[model samples]
Target: MEHNKRFLLVHPEISRNKYNFAGIIDNEPLELEYIYSMLKSMGYEPDIWDGQVETVSLAEKLKSFMPGYVYVCGRTRQESFMKEYCANSKEICGSTTFVGGIHAQHNYKHFYEDSIDFIMTSFDMFAIADILCGKSLSEIDGVCFKSGGIWQENAPKPFDAERLPVPDRTYFYAHLDRYRYLELLPCAHVRTAYSCPYRCKFCYRNRLNCGVYSARSIASVVEEIKGIECENIYIIDDDFLVDAERILEFVRLIKKNNIRKKYVCYGRADFISGHPDLMKQLKEIGFYYILVGLEAVSDRYLSDYNKLSDMSCNISAVEILNNVGINIMGMFIIDLDFKPRDFRELYKWIKSHKLRHTAISIFTPEMSSELMEQYKSRLITDAPCDWDYLHVVAKPSNMSVKQFYFHYHILAAKLFIKGWREGIYDFVDYGFYIRTILKNMFGFGG
Candidate 1:
C-alpha cells in the first residue's frame, strides 16, 4: 500500500477513418475524467493525457509525470495501443498498470498478461478506491487481477449512477476547444444516463453495462449543464429521450434556472414520433441537434435487427424533428443482405425526406456485439482491430465482397457530396470529407 500516490490516466491513441466527419471530431474523454475524479477523492493525485488531443508522446508524458500508477481506457479498436502504452509506462516508471473501459470490461481475459496488473469491470468508484488502497484483490468486487500466478476476478456489483461523483471537468475545460460534433465546435459531452433500455440485437451496450439503464438525478444533470463553459453540450446518453417525464423535467429545470447552452442528445424514432410536443419543448430550450438511429428503410430489416421501430416511425420522427427546426443526425446501418436496389432506395428516401445530416456505417458485428456470435464464421478478417465500423467485416449474402464495397463507395460519395452541395456542413469540412472519401475509394483498403 502506498500513501498519496500520483496516478496517470492515459487514453490510447487510435486512428479513425478520415472519410467520416463524426470519426474525425475530437471529443473530451469523459470516461477518464470520471476515473480521474474518483482517484482524486481517494487522496491520489491524478492527471490525464489524451492521445487523441495531446501532442506529447506517451513515453515523454510518463517520464515527466512519473506516476506510481498508470490507468488506460479504450475500446476494442485501441486494445493494442492500450497494451503497448501500459507496457511502456511500466517500463518507464515501474507503474502498476490498470486497464478499464469497454475493451477491458468484456475482454479482460485478453489483458491478463504480466504487463497489465488490474482491470476494472465496473464503474463503481468505491471498488476502484479499495483496489488502489491495496485491499485484497480477491475481496475487491468488480476487479480482475492475478494472484500467486493464477488469474481471478470477483463477481461484479451493480452500478448505481446516482452514487457516482460529479466528474471534475477542470481538465476537460482546459481542452474544450478541441472537441466538436460536426458543425458544433468546442462541444462538451455529459451523460445523464448509462446504457439503453431497449434491446437492439446489433448493439454492444449490453456487454458494457449489463443492458441495464441507470440515470442521474435531473438536479445533478442541470447542475452539470450550468457549469459547462462550452457553448454546445453533447449529451452522450445512449437514449436521452427515453422517459418523457424526465425530458420534461430537464427542460423545466433548464428554463427555471435560466441555464442556456446549445444541446445534442440521442433519441429513438418511436419516442420522437410519439411525443411531438416534448420535441418542440426540447427545441425551445436550446436542443438544436438530435442523433436518431434510423437503422433501415425496410420494416422487415428493422424487424430483423429488432430495432422495435419500423420505417413509418422513422419517417414520422424525422418529419417531427424537422418541423420543429431541430437538426437530425440520421444514423443507418448497411446490412450485408442489401442488394444494389436497397442502396438506391435508401438514398432516394434520404433525398425525398430532405435529410441533410447522416451517418451510414456498414453492418459491422463489432466484438462483443450480440450479432457477432451469429456472424463470427462469416467474418472476412480475423484481425480484431478491423471490427471498426468503417470496414466491411462480414461476407455479403447477395453480392461478392468486392461488389458490396463498390456500391458502398459510390453510396458514401453520393451521400457526402449531396450533403455538401446542399450546405449541410461547412465548405472547409466538405473539402476534407471529399478528400478522405477519395483516398479511401482508390486506396488499398477502407
Candidate 2:
C-alpha cells in the first residue's frame, strides 16, 4: 500500500441502557472536527464517524477507509465504547489507535491498553500530525506512548482557545438535523473558552487544561458564529457568564453584526443572581436558555460542595431568567446524605419556582475530582460507567440503597408529570423515558 495518509476520527456512542437520557441531548463532535480541520490543512485525508448520529458501523468504516491512524474521543461514560472502537480498529486493519477527550485528558492511564498506541493528554493536534509523519514519540509534547514495552508520557502544554483554527464543521453540517438540546433542534456546539475559572469542589471541569482558564476574544467568537448555519448554538463553555464585560461585548457584537442566533450555555447561579441586568441584555441578544447549576436547595449542602452560592441566589436566578423570558434549565444535585424529606423539599422548591425545565442528578464523585478521596471508602461500585450521576455509586448515609433509588425515581416521576402537565418537553416521548427509567430502577435494584 502506498504510504497511507488517511486519518479516522471517531466519537463513540453511549449505551442507552446505561444512560436513560441518551437521546434527549446529542451535541456535535466539535473536537474531532477541529482535528479534522487541522489534518486537512496539512494536506492529509481525514474523515469523521460520529457514532451518536451515524448509522454506519465502525467495523464498516475501518474496512472501507483502511486508515493508517485511528483516533477516538469520548467522556467517562463512553470510556468502554472508546476502548472498543480502538480495539476493533487495531484488529481490523492493524491501524495505530489513539484516544483523547476530557476524560482521557485527566485519566490517561485508564486507556493504557495494548490496542491503543497513544493517549493525547492535551489539545496538541500538531503532535499527532508529527507522529503520523514518522516523528519519534519522544519528540512530542502532551502525549503518552509505549516505547520498548514501557509507557512514557510527555509534559502537557496549556491550550489557548483563541489560537484554535476555525473548525471544519463538515461533520456538523452533514447531520445538522440530528443534533439537539431538548427542544432546540439542529443545535450546534461552539467553544469560547478552555476549562473553567471557578473552583467548585465537586466539579471536574475546573481541573482541565492544567487548571488554566483562557478565552477567545468576543470579536473572534462572533466571527465564528457568523459562519455557523444553525440558529441554535450551544456554547460548550464550563461557564459562559464568568466575565461581565466580555458578555456585554458579545451582545453588542451580535447586534452590531446583525447575526441572529439562539444560544444555550452553562452558567453559575451567583453570576446570574448578581447581574440581573446582564441577564436581560443576554435575553435581548437571543440567549434562549441558560443551564444554571442550582446544585442544592439548602445552604448547608451548597457550602459543603463549595459552590459559594446560597439557596437565595438560586431562587433569584430562577426569578431573573423567568422575568427575562429566557428558559431556565435548573440543574440540581441530590446529595448522598439526603433523606426522603430532602427529595420532597427539592420537588416542592422546583414546583414553587414554577420552573418547567429541570435536571436532577445524584451527587457523583468523579474519579478525577478532589472529592473522590473523601468518598472513596464509601463507594459502592468500582465501575467507571456508574459514576455518570444517574447511579448512586456511594452508600447513602441516611437510607438503604433501595430506599435511595426509590425516592430518586419517585422524584423523577413527579417532575416528569409536572412538566407534562405544564405542556413541556413535547419533543420527546414521555412514555419511552418513563419505561427506560423504570427498567433501570428494577435492574439496579436487582
Candidate 3:
C-alpha cells in the first residue's frame, strides 16, 4: 500500500517434475509468492503471473496493473530455460525486470547482458523497491546490474529471516489443478522459519545462507493461516519441525483455530529421533506426512556425504514415524556403494512399512554441494543443468556412469510400479515420471 509503489511478481512456471519436456509444469511458486508478500508489506502493489496459466504477456500485465518493477524466482537445474523467455517477455512489455533465485543469483554474471535489469540472491527483495522509486542503484544492496558495459555487484542484503512475510498464494490459487496431489485444495506453502541450521555441501541453502536461523512467532503464523482458504498446507520450510517448542505452539494454535488441514514438511532423522512427542502432536494436527533426507542407508555413505544420518537412525526413525501413522517420504541417493541387496532392502522397507513415497535420485552433485567439489576433477558433465544429466553426474568410485544410469532408471520404474500396486501414488510429485512413461509407451510428453 505504499503510494506510488507497485511490482509484478513472476514465479516462472517450470517443469514441476524435472523430466517433463512436453506439458507445462504447474507447481506452486512458493519462493516468488514470498517476494510478492514482502512487496505488499512494503506498501507496493504486486501482481503474480504463474507462467503456467499462459505465456506471460509482460506487456499485457504492465498495461493492466501498471506496476513499476518485476520480481521473479527461477530454479537452476529445471527452470533455467524459462528465464530468458520471461525476461524477453518483460522487456517486450516495457517493464523493469529484476530477477532473483538460486540460478539467477549464482550465474548473474553468466547471463549479465539480457532483459534482466537486476540479479539478486535469496534475500533483500525489498531493496528492489528502492531501485524502482528513483533511488540510485548504488544505494541498493544485493543487486547485480550493468553500468558502463560492466556488471557491478552489491553485497547480498540479509534475508530478514525474522521479518519473513507470509507468501501470497492467491497467485496460484486458481491454477492449483496443475500441481501434483494438490487438486484436493487451494494449497499454500509457509515457512515456520528461514534458513537451515545445517549446511550440507551439495545444497544451495548451505552455500548461500548463514549459520543463523530464524523462526516466525506462532501467533503471527496463525494470523496468516486465517486468510488462506486451503485445507492442505505444504510447509515449505527447509525443516518445519526443527524447533520442537515452536511446532508445539503451532499445533496448539491450529487446534484453537479449529483449522482442519493435512500437512507435509521436511524433517531430519536425528531431530525426530530426539523428539517423538512433537511428531506425535504434529500427526494429531493433520500432519499426514514428513519428508526426511535419508541420504544413504549405510553409515559409510552418509559419513562420506557429511549428512550426519546413519542407517540406524534411518531404520529407527522410519519405524517411529510410521508407528504414529504418519507417512514418510524417505529420500535416498543411490551410489556405487549400494548394491542389489541394498536396492532390495530399500524397496522392501518402503513396501513393508507403507511409506508415502521415495525419491531414489541417482546422486547428481548439486550446484555447490560437497559432492560437486569432491568430484569436480572427475565430473562427466559440467554444464549448469542439462536435466538429462541429472541422473548420472556423480559417479561412485566403483561404478560406471552407464551402469549407474541404467540401474537408476530401472529401479525407479520398479518403485513406481510398486507404489502403484500398493495404491500410494500421490506421495511424490514426479510429473516427470508420467511424462517419461508416456513418451515411451504412448509417444507423448516429448
Candidate 4:
C-alpha cells in the first residue's frame, strides 16, 4: 500500500432491529471521527460515511474518491454488513479493506477470510495510524494480517487515553440534527472514560479490556465539550458517575468555563443514590438526563447478574434524580426465565415508580462475555448477528417463544405510548409503527 493513499471509512448500515433506533436516537459516529482525525494528523486524506446518517451509496463514494484503502468498523450485530461492504469495496475498487471495532477486537478469526485484509485488534489510534501510513503489519502493535497465506497477529500496545485528540466534528456537520438522546437533538458524543469499574455480567465493555478503567483528563474532556457545536452532549463513557472527586472536578470545570450544553450520560444507581448533592449539582450544571441500568426489578436478578446494587439503590437513585428534576432513562433486561406474570409485574413496577422513559432489551449474553459459555446451550441460533439483544436469543424457560414475544411487544407498545404521553416524539412514520406491530403480532423479531 502507498504511504499517501486516500482512505475511505465506511460505517456499515446495521439492522434497525438491532439498535431499535426507531428514530428516538441516532448517535453520532464518534468512533469514525476519532479515526478520521488520527488519519488526517498522519497526512492521509480520509473521509467518513455514516450509514445511520448518510443516504449516499458507498460504492458510488468509492468510485468518486477511488481510495486505496477502505476501513470498516462496527459491533457484532453489524458483522454481516461490515463483511459485505468490505467484499463489495474490494470487488468494486480493489481497495485494501481493513476491519475493526468490537466485533474485530474479540473475534479476529471470524475476519480471516479473503474479504478482510487486516483486522485491528485494539482501537489504539496510533497503531491504526502506523498501519495506514504503510508500516509493515508485523511491526504494528495491534493488528492481524495474512503473511504468505498464514494469519499472523501482533500483541496490542497499551492505549494512552491522555493522547486522545479532540474529535473532528466537521465530518458530521451535514447531519448533526439527526443525532440525539430523545428530545435532545443535534447531540454530539464525548468519551470521558473507557471501561466500567464495576463488572456487570451481561455488559460488553469488559470484553473490550478486562478490568481496565482509563479516563481522559478533565481539561481534555472540557475542551472537547467546548468544541462541540451541538446543544446536547452525550458523554459516551461506560459509567461516568463512578468517581465522586472526578465528578466534582468535572462540574467545577464546566462552571469555570460556563459550558452550558444539555448533557446525557450513563451512571450507576449506587453512585446517584449515595450522592444526592452531586446529582443536584449536575442538574444545576445542565445534566438533564442520566441513563441508569436498572437492569432488573427484583433483587434476585440483580444479584444473579452481579450488579452489586439492590432494588432499593435503584429506587433511591431514581427518586434523587426526580427530586433534582433530571430525567431518568431507565434500562432493563428481560430475563429468559420470565413468566407471563413477570412481564406484568415489571410493567406495574415501572408505572408505580412513575418512570416516564424506559428501554427494554432481552437478556442476551453477547460475544466474548463470560455469560456466553453458560448461555450457549440455550441459544436459539448460532448466528453471530442474532446476538444483538433485540431478539430473545435464549430459549424462554417459562413461556412459549410466541407467547414471550407477544408480551414483549405489548410492553414495548406500552412504553412507546407512555413516552408519547410524556411528549416523546414518534420520530418515524406512522406506517412504520403499523408494520412493526404487524410483524410482532406474527412473531417475526426472533
Candidate 5:
C-alpha cells in the first residue's frame, strides 16, 4: 500500500473533580487547530478530536479514520491520557505516534516508550513536514525519536512566534456551542505573544520558549481578531497587559478597524494598579474580564515567590477593575506552610473585598520548574496528574495532609456558597458542583 498521509490530532480529557470546574469552562483546543492548519498547508489531510467535547471513543475514531499519523498534545495534568491515546493509536491502526506539548517538552524521558515514535520539544512544523516527506528522524533538530531501539534526543532550536501560521478554526466553528468560559459561551482564543516576560519562581509559562519572550505584530493580531466569528475573544497570552504603548496601539487599532469584540486576558496586579489609565482604556475597548494572579495576600509570600508585587498592588488591582466594570478573576495560591488559621484568614480577606469570582489553588511545584528541587525532599506524590495544583503534592510544614485538605475544602465550600448566593456563576449546575465538593471533602470520589 502507498504511504498514508492522513493525520489525527487529539486533545486528551482531564481527570474529573470539583477543581476541573467542568461544564463551567471548556476551552477550544487551539494547539491542535494550529497543527491542523500546518498539515493542511502541507497538502495532508488532518482531523481533530477534542476529548472534552467528543462523544465517540478514540478506538472508534482510529478505526474509522485509519490515519497513518497520530499526534497528541496536552499539559502535565493530561500526561497519562496522552500516553494512553498514543498506545491505543499504535495498537489499533499501527500509526506513527507523536507526543508533544509543555509537559513533553520539559520531560521527554517520560515518553520514551515503544508506542510513541516521536516527541517534539518545540513547534518546528517544518521538521514535522520533513518527517512526513521521508526524511530521517535523526535529521530533525528539536525532536526525540528511537534509533535501533535506543531513544535519542536532538538539541532544541529557539521558537519563533513569526513562523506560526494562523490556526484554522474550522473545528472550533463546527462545535461552537461546546466551548465556553463561564458565561461567555461560544468564545474564541487568540495568542499575541509566546512565553511570559516575568520571572515568578513557580510559573512554568515563563520557562517556555527557553525563557525568551516574543510578541506578534499588532497589525497581525488585530487582523486575526477581525476575522474571528465569535464576539468573545480570549487573548491567551501569558500576560497581555505587558507593554503600555503596545496595548494602547492595540486599543487604537481595534477602534479604527471597527472590530467590536469582548476580550478576556491575563494581567499582572502591579500593572493594573500602576496603570489605572491603561485599565480604563482596555475597559473602553470592551475588555470584559482579567484573570489576575494575586498569588498570596501576604507580602512575605510575594517576596518568596519573586512575584515583584505586594498585597497593596493586589488590593488596588481589584478596586481598579471593579471601578472600570471589568470582572476580576482573582487567582490565589495556598502555600504548604499555612496553618488552619491561614485558610480562614484568606477566606475572610476575600469576603471583605466582595470578590465573588475567586480561584484558590494549592501550591504545586512543577517538575519543569526550579522550585521542584527545593520541594523534592518533601514531595509526596510522583504521579503527573496529581500535580494539577488541586492536589497537595508536598508535605505541609504547619499541618498534616488531611488537615490541609480539610481547611482547603472548607474555604472552597464557603466561596462556592457565596458565589451561588450572589448569582455570579448561574450558568453552571449548582447542585452538581455542590455534590462534587462534598464527595472530594469526604474522600468518596476524590
Candidate 6:
C-alpha cells in the first residue's frame, strides 16, 4: 500500500492505573513521534495535538491541520469525552477517522459505534497505514469496525521495529514544557526499541512476547540524537539497560558527542541491581531518573503481580541508585488481593527504604497481556480506566473490589499525608493542596 497522506494524532491523558494523575510524570507524547516518522517515511505529514499540558479543542485544531485521517489513542479514563470530541472532529472536518489504543482496540465498535471509521489495536500500525492508503478495514489485522450493524475484525500485518525510522523529535522539542518533570531546554523523548521483552502481568507491551526485541543500532540511534541537536533527551526505551552492549554503545555515543540531555527511562530492578556501577555512569551521561518498577517489597507479593524481580533485588537496586546519587522514583503497586493488615507493612517498607519521590498506581488491565486475560476471566473487574484507579485494578485473589479500593486509598492517603508533612514531592506538596482548597473550597483528590 503506497499513497500520499496526512494525519493528526491525538493522545488523551487517560489513566494507565487510575492514580497516574495523582503523581503524573509530565512527558511528551512519543506515539506522535513514532507516527510522525512513519508518516514521513511514507511521504506524508503528521501534526500531533497532545492534550497533556492543556485541554485542546481538537476539532478547531483539525480545521487548521486539515489532515486526511485523525487518529486518537487512550484507554479508560476519558473515553467518553475523547470519543465525543473525535466524532465531533470528524463531523467538523468531513474526513474519515480512526481511534485506537488499548481501550478502543479491545472495544472500539462496542464503545464508539458510528463515531470511528477504523480501530487499530495490538501493535497493528502497518494495517492502519494500509487502510489509510485506501484498503478496506476488512483487509487489515488488529482492527475493528462496525459494518452493517456488526463489529468486523481483520487480521493485518505487523512491521519489524528496526525497519522504522527514528521518531522525528521535532514535535517533542516544540512542546517541551508540556512534559511534566523536565526542567531542561530542548528536551526530546526517543524510543530505542519498539516492543518490550518482559512478561510482567500488568504491562501492555508484553501482550504476546511480541518477538525477541529487535533494537535500533547504536549508530542509528546516536545519529538521530545528534541530528536533533539535542542538549538533553529522555531515553523512552521500555528498558534500555536490558541490553548491556547497546547500553555501552549508547553511553559511548553521548560521551563522544559530549552533547547532553537529561534522560528518563523505565527499567527493571534486576537490570540496575545487577549493574549499579554501569548505571552510575549512565546517570552522568544524562540519565537523570531510572524509573524502576519496584512493585512490592515482597517476592511473594511482587511475584503475584508477575514482577519477576525479587524483593531483595528491588531494595538493592534502590540502594545502589541512592548511593550513586541518582534520584529514584520507585513505582510500587498495592495489591487489591491483600488484607488491611498489608498497609502497615507496606508503609513500614517504604519508610525503611526511604523511598522518596515515589508513585503508587492501582493495578489496571491496560493491555491484552496477563492482566486483561485474567480480567476478562471474571477475576478482576475491567478496572475502571479512571485516573484515580491508577494502582489497584480489580478484585484481588482474595478481596472484594470495595475492600481493596478502600484500603488502597487509605494507604495512598497515608503516604501522601506523610510526605506532605515531611515535604517529599514538590508539585504534590501541601502548597498544591492549599491552592486547590482555595479554588474549590473543598477537600482535594476530587
Over 1-446, each residue of candidate 3 has an lDDT whose tens digit, in order, gives 13345667776544554364323224567777777777777777787776656554545665677665666677665345446644654555545767777677655675575666778754655676577566887877778888887889886745665576677777677666554332334456766676687766445555554344666788888788767777767777777767777878898999999888888789988878878888788888898778898877568777877777677788778888988987888988776566567767767766765665687765566665556676787666665554343346544565665555555565677787877677676444566665575443332111
Residue-level lDDT of model 2, residues 1-446, one tens digit each, is 13477889999876544464656799889999889999999988999998888888999999999988899998887888899999998899888888998899888999999999999998767778777777777888899999889889998888888888889998888887889998888999999998898888889888888889989999999999998999999999999999999999999999999988999999999999999999999998899999999998899998988898898899999999999999999999988999999999999999998888999989888886778889999999877777678889999999999899999988988998898888888888888878866776676632
Ranking by TM-score: 5, 2, 1, 4, 3, 6
Candidate 5 Cα errors over 4 Å, as ranges: 16-20
Residue pair clashes in candidate 4: none
Q: For model 3, what is the error of residue 261's alpha carbon versus the real structure, in angstroms, after optimal superposition?
A: 1.6
lDDT of each: 0.83, 0.88, 0.67, 0.82, 0.88, 0.67
Error of 6 at 39 (Å): 3.7
Off by over 4 Å in 1: 1-4, 16-24, 444-446
The global Cα lDDT (0 to 1) of model 5 is 0.88
Over 1-446, each residue of candidate 4 has an lDDT whose tens digit, in order, gives 65336888888665755235536677788888888888788778898877877777887887888888888998888888888889988888888888988788888888888978889887686777777556777789778988899999886654666777778887777786777767777788898877777878888785554347778888889978887778888998889998899999999999999988899999999889999999999999999889999999999999998999999999998899888999988999999999988888999999889888798988888776678898889878877777677777888898877788888888888877776677655655656665676677576574
lDDT of 5 by residue, 125-216 (tens): 66677778778777788899988899999977767777778999999999989899889998999988889989998889898877788888
Local accuracy of candidate 6 as per-residue lDDT tens digits, 248-339: 88888879978677777788889989998788888788777778889877788778767778988988988988888777778877665666
What are the candidates' C-alpha RMSDs?
A: 1.8, 1.6, 4.1, 1.8, 1.5, 4.2
Candidate 3 wrongly placed segments (more than 4 Å): 1-6, 16-18, 21-26, 38-45, 53-68, 179-184, 336-345, 352-356, 387-390, 426-435, 438-446
Q: List the residue pairs that clash in candidate 5.
A: none
